[model samples]
Each structure stands twice: as structure tokens, then as C-alpha cells.
Target chain A: MFNYLKPNNLLKIINKTQKFVFIIFLVIISIGLVEALILSPEDYKQSDSVRIMYVHVPAAWISLGIFSLIAVLSFGILVFKNKNLSLITKSLSPSGFVFNVIALVTGSIWGKPTWGTWWAWDARITSMLLLAFFYLMFLLSWRVTDDEKKAVKISSYIAIIGLINVPIIKFSVEWWSTLHQPSSVNIFTETSIHASMLLPLGIMTAAFALFSLLIFLMKYNTELIKIKNKGLDRL
Target chain B: MYGKKVKLRAIFILSIFFSLILIVFLVFKSLEENVVYFKSPTEIKDLTELTSKKIRVGGMVKEKSINVNQSEVNFVITDFKNELIVNYSGSVPNLFEEGKGVVAEGFLKDRNFFTAVKILAKHDENYMPPEVEEAIKESN
Candidate 1:
């Protein structure tokens, strides 16, 4: 399984899968946007402003999801001493950071029309900002450390410590008096959203997940190439 | 040597964890006082004392209770059993109207009077906009 970490093997996998993944991502995203923006009914209270939910919710979902992935991968790195897991974690962080940024920006825009404010120090928003800081710290750990081995260890620790913020972000609305509303969709029980709205949101979420996977694969391939070049320099 | 280095690293990491826990605890404790719990007009009326601290009052706008002045709007928030007057000077949201659920965030002047710095309109999950409803009615 670790043989896949080799540069030549990763290049072969990327060559075979990249085009297919790109086409699938593009097609799904295009269909999802049309369904979300046009096919879905306007919200009774928010009107068209609710359309931002299609983008905002998925971005927030991806951000949280990817950070959790990094945390798990970090565990694998420490427990199994798996270099491959570290590479994958490194690849996923930028996408997670980008999604976190998108979620914050879109949420601010959505808040203005509904909550009559661009920003608030509410628990939900503040926890999300904390999550963003964790992502930044994870990225910065790699940059500031000169020792490759030490960088991996530090970043892994950062990811594990930061995992606490994920649950806080998820439950902030329910646990505190926040301006942001509670989640419309809940996993333990029935979602509050109607099926008509759920379908488009589902599509967009799938598209975003697939898109993040594409980015991860590209980043993994680049990291493998860098490792190969470093080995050559050592020789 | 390897075991000793590992022990030091473990201690460092554990210290970081404990410090982070302490920070979060302190932050939440301080913020607890600042966090204003949402209350309904009925709940507010039942309160033993009305402090001047900021709070949020949420309930439906009473029918024909809104009076829009040149700079300020005065309205009544009702939970059917009780009603509280809310005074706001900033522009109201587009969805804010009679019978809609609203959350007013500000200091309470008294059980009968509340001054709102911000107003958030809450809507039900139903998708029947007035224009869409009118269109469907005409077609029917």
C-alpha cells in the first residue's frame, strides 16, 4: 500500500484519474448550481437571499469535514509513523482553509440581509473563527520549522489539538444564544428542511466534496514529486 | 536518549493541551456574563426583576402594533399571554412585519419597555411567498 507513495506510482494514478475527476466535478457542480439557484423555491422569509445557503452551507460542511480528515490523518501519522498520511494531510489543508474562508465570507453576506449585521461575536461565528486560526497554525507549523521530521510532528500535534474546535463549531448555535440559526439539517433525527431544498443542497455538497478530493490528489502528486527530487539530490 | 527525548516531547504537548483547556474555560466563563439569553415577552413579564443588562426578547409582532416614525419605529412583541413594547431607531429588515417572529437585541428599559439595537426577523420553513401565493390563487 505504501508503494503508492512513490513518485512514479502516484504520477501513474494521477494520469489515470485526474481527467475523469475533473470532468465529473465540473458536470456535477454545473447541474448543482442550476438546481440550487433556479429549480429550488424561494424561501418564504429570506426570499432569494436564501440561495446563499446552497454555497455557504456546503463550504462550511467541507471546511469542517476536511479538518476532521486532517485530524484523523495526523493520528495515523503519529501512531503508525506513516509518511504517506502526512503527505495527504499536507495536501488537504489548503482546500480546508479555502473552504473555511468561503464559508465565513458567504455567511457574512447572508447575515447582512437577514440579521441586519455583517458580523457578530456570536458563539457560532466565533467558534468558526477559532477553527480558521487552527488551520492557519497548522499551515504555519510547516513553514516555520526547518526540520522536516519536526515539522510533521508539530503539525500533527496542532491538528489533533485543534480537533476540539470542530464540535464547538457544530453545536455553538444550540449551546449558546447566537444570532446564527440552528442547523436546518440534523443527522440524529429528521432534518427541518423540505426535500425540495435538500436535493439541491445534497447535489452541491457532493460536488464540493468531489472538488476537494481532486485538489487533494493534485497536492499529493506534487508532494511525491518533491520527495523524489529531494532523494535524487541526496544521492 | 531516544526515550528521554520522547518524554520531554510528551510533556511539552501535554502542557500545550492543558493551557488551551484553561484558556477556553476562562474565555467561556467571562463570556457567560455577556451572553444574553433569548426570552419571550411572557417570560420577561414573569421575571422577578428587570436588570439594565443587555438581553434578547423574541416573539411575534402584534398586529397593527408598529408605528414607524421618521427615525424610530415602535412596536409590540407578543407571546399572546404578554406583550412588550420595543423601540428601535435603525432601519428594519425587509421581512420584519406584523405577526412575524422577531428577535430584538438590546437593554430592557423595564418589563413593559425594551430598546433594541438590532432586529432579526425569523421566518417559518414554509415556502409560500405572497407573490407566489397570489399567483397560485389566481390559477386555482
Candidate 2:
């Protein structure tokens, strides 16, 4: 299972599949944009502003999901002592942070017309802000350190510690009083969103996930090449 | 080759453990005050003092309670047992209407009055805000 993730082997796989991933990502995103912008019915109440959800919800979902993935990868490093796992965690951080920013900005844009405020100190909003802080700390661990090994170890720890915020972000609306509304799509129960709205949202989410993976592969490949070239300098 | 490296690893692990504890404590402490809970008109009426902290009031908009002017709109939020008047000076959400559930965020001026900075309607038609659901339930 873990064998495929070895740096050289993973680099070979990425080199082979990068084009396919990019093509699929482009196709899915184009279809999603069409469905979201043209096919879906305008919201009865929010009107065109509701279209923002097509981007905001998907970005928010990916950011939270990727952070959880980082936690799992961090644990894999502990169990297997694999440097590749640490490098992968580093590669995924920027994508997650990018999505986090998109979610916040889009949410604010949606909030202004609907919630009547650009921002609030609501539980959901605050926890997400905290998640962004954790992302910053993870990235800075790499930037501020000269020792590559020490930076990897410190970042892995930060990733693990940050896992606590994921569940909080998921349950904040249910647990506390917040300006943000509860989730529209529920995994176990029936979803409140209509199928027409759901289709574009699903497509957008798939596109974002594929795009993140594509970015991750490119980043991991670059990082691997840098390490391979520097192998002798460290010794 | 063995003892020094093992000792350093142990210290590194311990420091991370302590830092995690400190962060969790600080987060909860700050969140304790910032977390605002939803209160119905009945609940607001029960309160003896008008605190300065921001609060959210949720309930059905009273029938014919809305008074619109050039600058501001005033309405009453009711939970059957009690009602609190809310005044605001912004563009209300399109869904804001009489007999619909709405949540207003602002400060309480007195037992019966609220000056709202924002009025939030439901995010979707099928989804009612949980606070509004709870307020309706409590009212019944």
C-alpha cells in the first residue's frame, strides 16, 4: 500500500499521469462552470448571488478535507518513518491554503447581500479563521528553518495538532450560536439542496479535488528533484 | 551514538505535547466569550439586565409589525408568549417578511426592544436555521 508513495516511484507515476489529470481537471471545471452559471435556476430569494455557492461551498469542502488528509499523511510519517510522506504533506499545504482563502472571500461576498454583514465572529467563521492560522504556521515552519529534517519534523507535528480544528469546523454551527447557517448537504440524512443545484456543486467539488491533486503532483515532483539534486550537499 | 539522540527525540516530543495543550486551552478560553447563543422573545423578556454584548434574537416576524421609512425599517419579532421590537437601517434580505422566521443580530436596549445591525434569513428554502426551529419549538 505504502510502496507506491516512495519518492522515486511516486515521481514516475506523477510524470506518467500529470497530463491526464490536467485534462480531466480542465474538462470537469468547464462543464461545472456551464452548469452553475447557465443551467441552474436562479435562486428565488437570493437571485444570482446564490450562484456564489457553486464556488464557495466546494472550496470550503476541499480546504477542510485536505487538512484532514494532511493529518493522515503526518501520521503515516510517524508509522513508516517515510520522508516522502512529509514531502507530500508540504506539497498539499499550499492548495489547502488557497482553497481556504477562496472560501473565506466568497463567503464574505455572499454574506454581504444575505446576512447583511461582511463578517461575523460566529463559531463557524472563527474556527475557519483558526484553520487558516494553522495553515500559515505549517508553511512558515518550512520557510523559517534552515535544517530540512528539523523543518519536516516540526511541520508534521503542526499538521497533527491542527487536526483538532477540523471536527470543530464541521460541528460548530450545530454546537454554538452562529450567523452562518447549518450545512445544506448532509451525508447521512436527506440533503436540502435540489438536484439541479446539487449537480453543479458536485461537479465543482470534483473539479476542485482533481485540480488540487494535479497541483500536488507537480509540487511533489519539483520538491523531489530539488532533494535529489541536494542529496550530496547535505552529506 | 545512542543515548544523546534518544534523549533529544524525547525532549522534542514533550515540547510539542505541551504546546498543543496550551493552544487548546487558549482557544477555548477566547471562544467562551465570543460564542453567542440564540434567544427567543420569551427568553429576552425573561432577562433582567440588558448586557452590552452582542446577541442574536430569532423568531417569526409579527404580522403587520413592519414599519418601513426612508432610512430605516422597524418590526417586531414574536414567539407567541412575548415580543421584542427590532429596528434596523439597511437593506433587509429578500426573504425577510411577515410570518417568516428570521434571526437578528444586535444589542438589547431593554426587555422589549432590540437595535439590530444585521438581519439573516434562511440560507435555503428547504433548510430552516436551527435556531429558528428551536425558537419555534420553544414557543409551542
Candidate 3:
């Protein structure tokens, strides 16, 4: 089973899976865009500007979700000293950073028309900005260190430290008075959103998740190629 | 030996993770006042003394309480229990209306009145088609 984890075998698996993931991502995103933009209902008050929620909400969720995954994987690396897990985290951060930027920029644009201000130092917004910085630090730790062991150790510590921000970001609105409203969708309680808009949101979140998977596969495949070029047999 | 080392490392990592959470939890608790984006009208009304410091008061705009004049606009902000009259001299956001959420940024004149320099419309979490909203409004 361990021999099956070699770069040559992993590269073959990645190559086959990447193409299918890309195709699926493209199909889901196309359907999601149509649903979010064309079929979703215009907001009662915000009008067309509310459409930004489709992109903003999903992007925010993806960024937060990826960071939490990275934190958990980093914990695994710390305990088990898994080399492959570190590589996976290194590949995942770029897509996570991109989505973080998309969420912040789209949110700013949404705020201007609705809130009468482009930015506010509200709890939710500020914590999200901190999360972007945490992603930056985690990405930087990987590049700034030369030794593989050093890079892995430094990045793992950074992730663990950053993990604290994830819960803070989630509960920011509930814990403080934020310019942003409290969550309308809850799993345990009733959801305030109408089904028409909720449908688009759900579809868009699925599409974004698939798109992130495509990015991760391509990135992980490249890492495998590099290892194969270096004449390494296993991670 | 290797298994024992890994076990120790796992304990170390979990301890570190929990401690970091504890430290941050305390820090956020300490900075509670600063993190609050706005105060409600009820909170303002409960204040024993009013200060001229710039603050944000947020609540629903009372129906039939908005009075617009050439120089300034006055409206009452209500939390359904306590109400504060706000005077502002600026353009309001598009979502500002009676029976809607708002946050006024300015100074407090007294316990019952606030002087605002800027008005921000706070939108609720509800989203639906305009027709559906209209129907809901009619039934109300």
C-alpha cells in the first residue's frame, strides 16, 4: 500500500482525475452562473445588487472552509510527520487566498451601494481581513524557508496559530454588533431565506467547491511531477 | 519508540491548539467594546450621562417619524422599547426608509436625542422577489 503512494503512481492517478474534475467544475459553474444570475429572484429591497451575495457568500465560505481544512491537515502533519499532507496544504493555499480576495472585494463593492460606505471597521469585516493576512502569512512561510523540514514546521505552526481566527470570523456577527446582518441560514434553526434564492446559493456553493478541487488537483499533480523529476520514489 | 514519540507530539500539538484558542478568546473578550459596530437606541437611553464623543446608534426607523427640512432631516430610531430622535444633515442611503433598519453615526446631544453627521442604511437578512415582498407587505 505504501509502495502505491510513489510519485509515479500518484502522478498517473492525478493526471486521470484532474481532467474529470476540470470538466465537472466547468459544467457545475456554468449551471451555477445561470441559476445565480438569471433565474434567482431579485432581492425585495436591494434589487439587482443582491446578486452579489451569490458570489460573495460562496467565496467567503470557500476561503474559510479551505483554511480550516489546512489547519486540520497541518495538525496531522505535526503529529504524524506526513510529507504528502504538507504538499497538499501547500497546493491548497493559493486557491484559498484567491477566494479570500474575491470575498473581500465583492463585499466592499456590495457595501458601497447598500451601506453608504465602502468600508467599516466592523467586527465581521475586520476579522475577515485578519483571515486574509493569516493566509498570507501561511503562504509566505512556505516560500521564505529553504529546507523542506523547516518549511513544513514553520507553515504548520502558522496554520495552528491562524486556526483561532476561523471561529472568531464565524461568530463575529453573533458576538458583536456588526454592520453586516446576522446569518439568515441556520442548520439547527429555521432558515429565513426564500427557496428561490437559497437554491441559487446552494448551487453556487457546490460549483465553487468543485472549482477549488480542480485547482488543488492541478497543483498537487505539478508537485508530483517535480518529485518525479527529482528521481524520488515516494513522498 | 517511534510510536511513543508520535504520541507525545500529538499531545503537544493539541495542547498548543487549545492554549491559542484560550488566549484569543480572552483578548476578544477584553476588546468587546471596541468591536461593537454600533449601539442600540435602548442602550443609549439607558446611559446615565450623555457624552459628545462620536458614536453610532443603530435601530429601526420609526414609522411616521421622519421629518425632512431644507437644512436637515430628523427621525426617530426605535428598538421597539426605547426610542432616540436623530438629527442628520446629509444624504441618506437608498435603503433608508420608515420601518427599516438604520445606523446613524454622530454625537449624542442628550439621553433622548442624537445628532448625526452620517446615516447608513442597515439591510436585514431577508431576501425574496419584489412581488413576494409586496404581497407580504399587503397582508401585513
Candidate 4:
């Protein structure tokens, strides 16, 4: 069953669904924008500046989510010899790196008004910076070598090693006395964020997830085309 | 064959190097004093000995404690367990307010008073509309 999802089948599926994915992305993003900017009330303290959270938080979430997925897929690639997953981990990275940069940039912009500093060597901020470096090193591991076998092994190892920083980034605020506050959005317990704000945040996160999916489809299709051009029947 | 060996060696070395870095970071995390961005007023008071080095004392600015004279500002940061007086002459962050979270950065004058050079406003995790906040306040 898994064999049927060969590179050729992926190409066909990608071409058929690309436009629909794009349309859905656009529609969700539009709704997200309205909900985040207008419908959500201004924060009692931060006021209009709080609106920046709509983009910053979603971008951070998407970046972290994508990296976690890549790490898991890399683990399969190394241990189970699932070569097909390498293409996925490869294609997923550019959007992940882009969102990582977006999160950092937006966080910097948000910090200037709230924390009175554009940047700080705070624990959470530094760990996030380290994650970006990991993403960079993973992306570079592919280009630095032309041999696909070498590239896959090196990149997978990098992913597995970099995953140690993920939890550190998540808990940096609680572990240390950082400038950033504790997370309000809890999963196991009641969330501190109000329903009005969480609603927009959820929509924005969905839109961003769809957008990353669209990006992945295009990149995956291109990789498949490359394989087909080389007369390779399998990836 | 020689080139292949070199490439393999390079990959081996790189993996070891990255793994070592992660291990070092994990080991370093155990030592908390080196990493804290700021210390609460109570934590500062509990210290066995005070260092002359610059440190940030963080907590809530006690209500009615803010005294602004010209460019100088004085306030008391309390953790509800202990309080520290901070005197500084600086333009504070926009969010700085009485009864709000704050962090003062400067050298300590003594155990009870600090000579601050900068004031940063800190906020809680709670976020809501002004109206909603007012209503909650009224209901309370």
C-alpha cells in the first residue's frame, strides 16, 4: 500500500490538488486577518501592540511544528530505511526556515514596544535563535554534498540532534527568569487566554498550516519531477 | 576512495561536534544562577551574600510607590514576601505603571535599596480587552 505512493503518483496528486489547496489557504487567511485585526479587542495593557501576537505566535507555532515533523520523519529515515520520507523532510524545511525567521523578526518588532528592547540575550530568545541555526545547518547539509546518500544521512543526524533544543525553547521561560512570560495557552489544563483572542489565534494557525501544506506540495512535486526526469521510477 | 574516506570522516567529526554542543548545553542548564535573566525581590533578599555586579530585580511595582522628580524615578518592587526600593533616573518603558510588573537593572546600594539605571515593564500572561478588564474589576 505504501509502495503505491511512488514519486509519480505524488506528482499527479500534487498537480490535481495544488489549486484547491491554494484557494483554501487564501480564504482561511482572509478570515483570519479580519478576526485577528478587527474583531479581537485591544489588550487592556499592550493595547494595539497586542495585535502583533496574531502573526508572531502563529508563525512560531508553525515553525516549531514543521521542525518537529521533520525530526520525526528523519528518525524514520534513519532507523526504518524509509527513503521516500527524505523528500518530504527536504521539502518541508524551506517553509520551516522561512517561518522561523518570520517568528524572530515579528518577535523583535513586538519586543521593542512591550519589553523596551529590540533584542535581548534572554533564554527563550537565544534558544529560538539556536533552532534557526539548526534549520540552517539542516538545509545546508543537502547542498554541501551532491551525493543523495550522504546528504540524507547527514541531514537526518542533524535533525535528531537538534531536537534536544526544542523542549528547551518551549520551557525556557519557566526554567529561567526570562523577559518573556509563561505560556497562557495550555493543552492539558484551562487556557488563560480569552476565547475571543484564542479564536483568531486558532484560525490564523490553521491558515498558516494550510499555507505550509501548499508550499510542501509544490516542492514535493518538483522533487518528483526531478526524479522522473532522471528516469528513476522510485524515490 | 581517498576522497570518499575524507567525506565520511568529515561527516563523522561533524556529528560528534554537534552532539557535544548539545551535551554541554544540557549540563549548563543545571546551574541555575548563571542563567536567570532577573531575580525577584524575595530571591534577592534570601541571598547569602550580595554581589556588587549589576543585576536586574524584578517584581510588581507597589501601588503609590512611584515617585517621579524631574528625570529621577523611585519605586518599590515587591514580591508580596519582600520589597526592594529602586531609585533610577531614566525614561521608563511605556507599560511601566504602579501595581504592574517591573524589572530594574542597576547595582545594589544595599540589601533594601538599589540604584537602578534602567526600568523595564513586565506584564502578566493575562490579556483581555479594556472593557472586559474593567467589567471583571467591577464584578470583583
Q: Name the candidate that leads on lDDT.
A: 3
* DockQ score for model 1: 0.31
Q: What lDDT is reached at residue A218 by model 3?
A: 89
For each candidate, C-alpha RMSD in Å?
4.5, 5.6, 1.6, 4.8
Minimum summed lDDT over a 10-residue window in model 4 chain B is located at B1-10
| Cα lDDT of model 3 by residue, B23-118, tens digit | 888987898878899999888877887877999999999999999999799999999999999999889999999999999999998988899999
Better of 2 and 3 by DockQ: 3
| Residue B123 shift from truth in candidate 1, angstroms | 4.6
For this target, which candidate reaches the highest DockQ against the unseen true structure?
3
Candidate 3 stretches with Cα past 4 Å from truth are A1-4
lDDT of 4 by residue, A59-126 (tens): 99899999999988887676555667898999999999999999999999998899888887778899
Q: Is the docking of candidate 3 incorrect, acceptable, medium or high quality?
A: high
The TM-score, computed over Cα atoms with residue i paired to residue i, of candidate 3 is: 0.96
Q: Residues A2-65, candidate 2, lDDT per residue (tens digit)?
A: 5444456666888989999999999999999999999887764566778999999999999999
Candidate lDDT (C-alpha), each: 0.84, 0.82, 0.90, 0.88
Model 4, position A234, has a per-residue lDDT of 72
- Per TM-score, what order, best first? 3, 4, 1, 2
State the TM-score for model 2: 0.83
| Between candidates 1 and 2, the lDDT winner | 1
* TM-score of each model, in listed order: 0.84, 0.83, 0.96, 0.92
Residues A5-37 of candidate 1 have per-residue lDDT tens digits of 456766788877988999999999999999999
**Candidate number with the higher TM-score (2 or 4):** 4
For residues A87-152, write the lDDT of model 3, one tens digit per residue: 899999999999999999999999999999999999999999999998999889867978889999
